[model samples]
Target chain A: MNQKTALHAFDQAVALESVGTDTFCGRSPEAYANMVGPYGGIIAATLLNAALQHDERQGDPISMTVNFAGPVTDGGYQVVASARRTNRSTQHWFIELSQQGVVAATATVLLAVRRDTWGDTEVSMPHVPPFESIDRLDIGRYLTWVKNYDFRVVQGHFDPGGAIEDTGDSLTRLWVKDLPRRPLDYLSLMAISDCFFPRIFVRKQQRMPVGTVSLTTYFHADRDSLARQGDRPLLAEAHAQRYSQGYFDHTGKLWGEDGELLATTHQMVYFKD
Target chain B: MNQKTALHAFDQAVALESVGTDTFCGRSPEAYANMVGPYGGIIAATLLNAALQHDERQGDPISMTVNFAGPVTDGGYQVVASARRTNRSTQHWFIELSQQGVVAATATVLLAVRRDTWGDTEVSMPHVPPFESIDRLDIGRYLTWVKNYDFRVVQGHFDPGGAIEDTGDSLTRLWVKDLPRRPLDYLSLMAISDCFFPRIFVRKQQRMPVGTVSLTTYFHADRDSLARQGDRPLLAEAHAQRYSQGYFDHTGKLWGEDGELLATTHQMVYFKD
Candidate 1:
């Protein structure tokens, strides 16, 4: 297929076919495959998409929490999204993603109709050079999903050798966008929230087995604001708080090119030392 | 009832009676009442207690996310806790709370058997005066639930008149413990994770109609460590990130008296101007 006619890899990966009422079928594409299964970001986005495409969906997503119950195998999977409760301005959803009749992931999404209100951003965006000023770090050698995004690291680049000897913090600030530059939307924004390398790898200075147990993202920007962002690279930063008892959690923030806070995300991850 | 014979208010509030396999009956106690409903913290703890009391519970709680679907009335309720998936060392649960046949809240909890590992706390505990040195703040006149916890504010005390005109940040640092000094456990820890007053009250300096849409807490301390804390006050701190589009989010941390990081929580709330 010609470049213009070809579908974006992300769209293909998260695409779902409606099979029944409030139910959809999806598949894990090879393009976004990780070492074991698929990239978690794609799985999270796919789950959110199930609710976003629901016939009874009321408003834009405000908050979503996706729990990785188990490893999703490479094959066909089914998503069941149900609106457990609906109010005048808000709706609550319970979504489940299963493969071969076994539950793999579950998510709870909160959608609401937001209005203009007295607004403020307490946290300021980090100071970083323009996206064009930094060189793109090629990480496609390690993970196939990394090839789908263009990453310009401003700090906390994953260095195996230097990380062990140097006592540096686990803070990664980067400029990233889709490989072919897709427009900024809730789906893409959801995927970008998990695009950061596991903070343990950067903190311990060594590659270890890590999996996100649960992830929560809150959208601050509305539909119109996100659409105005276009395909610009968002300024993203993440940092870890505590690593104990074989678990750690990190909080992240994403900003538009004009420094508008788009979304904030948090996740608890399990790691093997 | 005598003091020794009487059950603690918190214990009575979160008490549940098993009805069937994985189903339990609970109630909204008048002691823990909020302005509109029971405190969100008590509801979250009650849900966690269901899983903890389940027969199939595998390990301690690592993380939990509770979404408030609707206003729970002041009366009896039912909770259904299901182990959606169980792995060797990890288990996932989906819990639902209903009142009069309508779902009022839902939660997803992750439990795992954690082993000793290399540990570190990236974020340092904020320096504050000892709990004994700070003066106690009595706020029971505004909300009934405030009577359950003894609070000592070190900074960011809620002031209506001063907050309206003074331009300051929304950061609350306090030392708090159960009013009757109960032992610290997973259930009480979960409840304490959400005891902070709404960050907006501190930010906007005015009490508006605000509700928590979703709450997530990650526990870093193990059962032994929490048991060691026994009836001691925890140094808690909370701060907001962004407030826009009729929504806001806050990140909080709770540390033990010995500076051991215990839990980290994040919540997204809905607010009216």
Candidate 2:
């Protein structure tokens, strides 16, 4: 779909009667490219949108788990969501995504309320270069689209490397924000989130895209902090659970404009080495 | 390890830990397994454990996302979990897994409180066979050695297929219980939560193993719900998300006696058809 079309569709999807988390499961057309090939992140995030709408126990709707069911064939599909329990301490929902009349993906979502206390702030955040110290690497694809973001190296090259604790001390710290001309939004949150791949591969010179196996994300904080980035980007860090059998799971922490963290996620992905 | 020794260690681990969401960053021998061949359900439960310990806002924790990280290997590892925002309308956390001093896996978790109202309930739980009607299908390599317990699928068949969801139905309600029978604990919850693959192929005569790529789980209630009767089992209904590119994500929901919704999970898995 074209930009305007995609945007219109996104808006429609967001407003659809069946789109919200509290509603029954319904698949968005944006979940697919053609039909069979699923847009991994989009499908997963859309599911998140479906569950958070009803999560009552969670102080915030911040985390989700999804399973990729089929080839994401270019066929239209529907999403259905239900809950097993709505306990006051926790609310859990079960969702099934069907494509071509078959279950394509299923997920369970957990959300919790926030308890803010100036707890023991003993564990210090990782140290990395300042956002302004480095020149942003452009590896084609989405370079112009990324001018609004910023990052610092904490580990690997800023490319998608799904390797867990490699032998090297490769790490990255990114500060992401939109250009003054364009502000940020939920889609922007996902857009910057989509950029974590390169930031994860900081030690490398080339960019590698991995077909993620699964993704778990938490959006616990507000985006206001990101709005204050000025010329800087958000600070983000990612780590691989491990790399074995051609698949890997990685988790990341996305810090808001302040030193406080905004969101976090763990992703299982497959990469072509 | 001897049962006494293992039990002692487990108790110590549970004790050394105060229930802080940050402390939920689970680092343990089990954490190592996620790095190298850890079963998907186990990984999901571990991630949930941490999210529960940390969440401050969203009432309780709801929702989870598990994407494939690496091939399951054999090794012991540790996990460190911390909340991105512990006091939000909902809560989120960042967890990192390390094996042999290397980061092995990472997870993002969301927590929400529970609410039961017409505006909140959108979907109904799927149907599975009665826990008493089905038999246990021994699938796991370690299942033979009852890790202080034994669980039987009273709803679905122990065989691979015959009335299974695709062939059976959308549910599998099984009766699971600890062998020696102790108070409900996290280990028992972890051990029993794994039911998707074997249950799927159970209706058939053939035995097929679904090697999981990744797993994410959400706990709606508390650990007490897992205390199933030794005579009856939990009924679980599971279905494949889809299977192609030689990979797919599958999911299952477990219900206890009196049809109480216990827990749910999504497994990113690969099954050799």
Candidate number with greatest lDDT: 1
Model 2: residues with Cα > 4 Å off, grouped in runs: A1-39, A53-59, A73-76, A115-122, A127-139, A142-155, A158-170, A178-194, A198-209, A219-232, B1-273
After aligning candidate 2 to the native by TM-score, how far in Å is the CA of A181 from where it should be? 7.1
Candidate 1 pairs with clashing backbones:
none
Error of 2 at B224 (Å): 34
Question: On a 0 to 1 TM-score scale, where does candidate 2 land against the true structure?
Answer: 0.43
DockQ of each: 0.86, 0.03
- Model 1 lDDT per residue over B24-109, tens place: 99999788888689999999999999999999999999999999999989889999999999999999999999998899999999
Chain A TM-scores, per candidate, are: 0.96, 0.66
lDDT of 1 at B143: 86
User: Predicted candidate 1: interface RMSD?
Assistant: 0.8
